[model samples]
Target: MARTNPLQFVQQVRSEVGKVSWPTRREVMLTTVMVFIMASLTAVFFALVDMAIRGGLRGVLSLFG
Candidate 1:
């Protein structure tokens, strides 16, 4: 394989970095908020499901006892 000098490696890294289209501050904030909202909704959904299952199990045990 061919090897690059230190200077050439630096230049190549800078060139690649310049090609990146970084997200705007507003876009980043919006995406972060969306992720948090989705995560919270998922947590709530699972909490409700867990509560339902727990209640069903308790009721069944009470009937047997």
Candidate 2:
């Protein structure tokens, strides 16, 4: 493979970085909020599921004991 010099590498890096479409501040904030909301919902859903399983196990065990 061919190797580039340090200066060429830096130029290439800048060129690639310039081609990127950065997100606006509002877009970032909206996505961040959405992520937090989804995460909270997921956590609550799992917590409820865990409680149900735990309650079921306790009830079954109580019957045998």
TM-score for every candidate vs. truth?
A: 0.90, 0.97
lDDT per residue as tens, model 1, 1-65: 99999999999999999999999999999999999999999999999999999999999999999
Stretch of 10 with least lDDT, candidate 2 = 1-10
Off by over 4 Å in 1: none
C-alpha lDDT (0 to 100) for residue 43 of candidate 2: 100
User: Over the stretch 10-62, how does candidate 2's per-residue lDDT look in tens digits?
Assistant: 99999999999999999999999999999999999999999999999999999
In model 1, the number of clashes is: 0
- Per-residue error (Å), model 2, residue 45: 0.3
**Residue 21 accuracy (lDDT) in model 1:** 100
